[model samples]
Target: MKIVIFGGTGFVGLNLAEVLLARGHEVTLHDRSPLPPAAQRSLADYRERLKVVQGDITDAQGIDALMAQGCDAIVLGAAVTAGDDLERASPARVLEINVMAQIPILLAAIRHGVRRVINLSSASAYGAAGQRHRILDEETPCDPVSFYAISKFTSERSVARHAELFGGDFLSVRLSAVFGPWERPGSVRDTPSLQFQILAAFARGEPALLPAPGIKDWTYAPDVAEAVALLIEAERPRDRLYNISSGVAWSALQWGEAFAALHPGLECRLVSPGEKTVIKLHGGDRAPLSVRRMADEFGWRARRRAPCSGRS
Candidate 1:
């Protein structure tokens, strides 16, 4: 399979690219950043097997040229992630990069006969999860709370509309808290509240700030990459949207304990913030998508291995 990945130079992109390459699939990575030194060294052997296109997604001409290379599928992994000051920034620029930029790329792919498209969506689109509603599934109502979530949700709708109009294949994977190796510096690899507290304590050798109590269903990067590969290879794709997550919930305290277990002798005072109730989504008793569905349709399974190091 010849797969083109937008923003393939980042954490998730690199992991997915590695998985596809190992399976003997031709891979093309489109990104504006120069290939990181680590990735360049790691993928050196397969330099010819992989193509890197340096251009912004806003550049329609460049995207058209990339699509002209005859990609079998395109994975839209590019996005402006959260933590930005959305209020001060221009909303038009935000939409241009996150929503409008996809138009030309998807159009070009369709024009060039691309078979399928996989869009990366965020679990945050379901809004803050709380005690009453623990799990958010594909059918759940979207209550996006942040600009990033809004952009991702809008992009998913746009992709679906394009698929409906063109009679093409598309799937949006609503991903939960994802973390593993190769994460970029200061990237949101951990839950935001947890990350801030952990970094302050561990990296800066300062006391930890307790996170407001909440449960998150975290997914490992490798597991997510494998699931994506299987979704691409599925003979008959069923759901247009699937939750890519571990399906197990862990509290912030549990995460902190896990981290402390990993690195003993790391003594730091802990400060607990008063408990605050937040919306909890997608951590219910039943699996959002049954194992049978994945097995019968896409041949995917939850990886039951131990959590990756540095995670709780």
Candidate 2:
């Protein structure tokens, strides 16, 4: 398969690209930044197996050219993630990257007869369900609380519309906190409260900060990439949206304790939830999404363990 991936240098994208490349698929990565030396070296090892193109999604001509390369499928993973302070953020740019950019690229994909698209949506779109104990499925009502969520939700809707009009298969994976290797340093990695605390402490050789006692699921990036691969290869396409996450839930304290156990030499401190700015995590109480739909239809499962689970 010839796969064209948007935002391929980032954490999730890089993991997905590696998976696809290993499976002998032709991979082309489109991104705004020049490939880092490490990424360039990795791709170089693949020779003709991989290609990286530097282009802006906002540029219609550039997107069109890439789409014209006869990609079998497109994966939209580019976006300005959450954690930006609204005061210094450009809502226009945010919307441009998340929502507006999809228009031209998707249209070009359709024009070029691309077969499928897997859009990376966010769980944040469900908003502060705050102990509502609601199970958020594909049909869950969207109450986006932040600009990032709003943009992602709008983009998913836009992609659905394009899929309907253009006669191409589109799948939206509403992802939870995706963590693993190749993590970039920015809002995408830091926005999650637990990760923010872990990364900060790891940087300083201190303990991670824990959130208030609450349950949440964190999906590993490789598992997410595997789920995406199955979605791409499914024989019978189903709903346009699916929640990709670990069915199990863990409290913030559990995560910290687990991490401390893994690296015994690291000093661990559990901070009171009161010391942290409290933003309600959107999806915790919901019953685990039945992978039966994906399993029966496409044979997808959570293939990776949680970070602190101490399971390889």
Query: Which prediction has the highest TM-score against the true structure?
Result: 2
Candidate 1 lDDT tens digits, 174-278: 776666655653332222444335544677654444533334565677778988888877766887887787767655445555666677755323344553322
Candidate 1 weakest lDDT stretch, 10 residues:
277-286
| Candidate lDDT values, in order | 0.69, 0.72
All candidates' TM-scores? 0.83, 0.86
* C-alpha lDDT of residue 105 in model 1: 86
Question: Every model's Cα RMSD, please?
Answer: 4.6, 3.2
Candidate 1 yields a Cα-based lDDT of 0.69
